[model samples]
Target: ILIGNLFTGNESMGNGGAIVVKSNSKPKIINNTIVNNHSLYGAGIWMSCSALNVVLQNNILWGNKASESGNQLYLRSTGSTYSIINNLLEGGVDSILFETPYSGILQDNYMFSPEFADYATGDLHLTCSSLAINAGSVPVVNMPLYDMDSNLRLNGSEYDLGAFEADAAATIVSQPQNMIVMNGDIATFTVVANGANVYQWEVSTDMASNWAAIVDDTIYSGATTSLLTVNSYAPMNGSLYRCIISGNCPQVTTISLPALLLVSNPDGFDENPIAVSVYPIPAYDFVNIIHAAGSRVIISDINGRIVADYAALSSDNEQISVSNLNNGVYFMKITSSNSTQIIRMIKD
Candidate 1:
């Protein structure tokens, strides 16, 4: 009996290059691939002397060469009981089997080349579109639990014909990259992953420490696909974005690395540019803001943390106290009725 055996690249001067059955010996060959053998009679299998009750199920007997009849099988036995079910053959049972008054069951046998992953390199794994996938019948006895590669035997509807099961794992080809865009402009992020169908993009405000799923809105689009678009805003600075991918293989999910979003405030963004000025480069007591009146001012440290905020500058050249702040570089964002401007500030 042969179960899950690979027979290839063998030669013989006589009969049976790979296997031989004689003297009424009944053999059960299940889930074996017999190919690429050369012999004078049967290159794959030679049976004689009334071998009865032979069972050949879920096997592949193809690509064999012989000098005489039966390139795949030479059966010289007569009145032998045999069952050849769900076996993929090279010639569809008429080109190989040479028996007088054949008495056996030949059901669900296919005549086509089983598309191997690589035939020259001896990689017998089935490809994605192989005809042997899900083509075997249900085994009533002596069914192996796993294939030759240790993959589950029945990954799909039924058993596969050959040795190895197909691998269907998803592979992440590309990841999203960081983007820098001006405020009020649009930014795009894209990812590429093979064998993946589901994509969910998320955003994090605190450098990926926390995440929230992004949806279709005024600021974001294509959040559920490989590409994600965002409308750049001042508040979105230092935000992080990533994508969660899944749905190619069973119970397999993955997430991409976080990408930073840096939003810059461009000059003359508004139609009417406003004159802005700030005094005291390294201020000790107070910094004067000489800009349009009734403007909002925001001060942040180098780490993008808001340190101080002031609104509704009632007078031109308003004085902002900087005595309580630490001695370091800071950023000041001033917004007026017409335009906005960002300036660098220093405290000593």
Candidate 2:
């Protein structure tokens, strides 16, 4: 029985990085963190046993690499009796080898990053932002009293999905920043928070007065995850977006600040004869503009307020520092002797 263990950085030339169950063993692997292991097959675990009553539950298998396939797990026995439940697998079904007409119970598995606190130094502790917090199977019989870190196994009503349990409090790591995109372009907003929580992104068209829950449709995607993407159009301009994150075990909830979306140049910009380039969209600190010398440049916010202006450009490459600007949308207009070009900018 392998329980409350950490299996990491192991390598194998043939089968498994951590464990290679043969044709006869019945192993119970529960509540473990198996990560960063590599092998030719099944970088985390490889089980080919035809034995009965093999159990695997409440474990995390992530960030493992395999040369052939099954980077997390490989199941070679098609008729083995097994039980797999409530594990965080990185690649979902694709993480396992093929076994048709399987004889096992697989339930409540997740296919996302477990979000370890410090993966580089091999500290696999659960961070406040880990989805593994309070994500395990409920009513687990004969479970361990404490996790691998010696913390209480059940920090909340339910056990966490990994070998470590996080604290109950939920905190936002980074709020979703505003986006600026051209008409027909895609705009995305992402939020980073600490905890295993439910996420629901909402939109407010009436300037943060009334909000409506967004759904997966032709207009938007990932309304339920921390990241949201929108198929932007002119009508989505000035729309406010926010995410509602909630967690259990005291029921902590957080509502993020509403960020505005700006769609620039709904009618599209006129083409200029001379080639002008503005690069690194969704810029964080600095944005570069390259064009002909002696071109005049002007930058304005969504409200048509001039933020930065240059009377005449002396060089081909001009760097504009957007470090002080608030996260949102802006427009840049560059004019040469004969032609003028306007481009949309997003301060991410």
Candidate 3:
């Protein structure tokens, strides 16, 4: 029974690189570095006979034992009980696992990342995309809620898969300026960006930098190259409006004047039965097909799923029932024999 550390000088045994205890010894093995020791039996430190109750705290067990058995540390019916806590145990293939009918408690210990760092640094900071975030099977005696480096774990559902969690944060941006408009009473609006992009808008009353004022915003779903009458309840009041673009575009945002002057719509609309609001596209039940001044209609889904054949009826409105139909995702191919336009619709 002792209260101090004992530095063994038996490098000849080639097991206790730093300090190894073979016989039964009741010692407070605190804050020591056990390394670079190799052994034919227990490369790091081989223990047999005698009860070795150790208070292994802040100690390191690595690169020592390289025996045929456990390269790091080994215990073979040591007839000893060990309390290994807050220590670093790095093994080769078997890492840190013992099965000798000998049982002990292992906890608050870290065994991932660098798995091989300067023992003095104690910097177990793991990089993002680390596979060792939460991959341990054994539980510690008194598991430290935090890792060796004192970082919080499992902010979400469950714990990570290893020692480190790639503690990284993402950035979210809002309200980018990229619209063109004029000082008008009311007009059509079109939003455009360099690449195929999307946008949403917020209403503001002032044009000055002092934007203490705030207004509600509207979110647009899917993607549309052009939009008409882009007006919000809030008055433009000569205030510069903006269209924030997102998705697969440049990160740096851009702003433009309120879109009240110029206007634009989709190209090749004549292909569609103009004035004919094709309803329930990708329809199942009944689809209401509207037509222009003098027009007829034919429809088909992308996969050629269903084709509705109709005559050139001289009517402004027509109803095509498509009840007993399958359920899935499909696009609309509407045509008037003269011009054709493909409009995408979803099936319920």
TM-scores for every predicted model: 0.50, 0.48, 0.30
RMSD of each: 18.3, 19.4, 17.3
Q: Write the per-residue lDDT of candidate 3 for residues 38-66, one digit (tens) a residue.
A: 65656555555467565445444555555
For model 1, the superposed segments whose C-alpha errors exceed 4 Å read 49-51, 169-348
Where model 3 places Cα greater than 4 Å from the true spot, the runs are 1-15, 96-99, 114-348
Pairs clashing within candidate 1: none
**What's the lDDT for residue 137 in model 2?**
76
Write the residue-wise lDDT of candidate 2 on 148-251 in tens digits: 66666666646777677765535678988878788799999998887737888999764455789999999999999999999999777668788888765334
- What TM-score does candidate 2 reach? 0.48
User: Which ranges in model 2 have alpha carbons more than 4 Å from their true place?
Assistant: 99-101, 139-141, 167-348
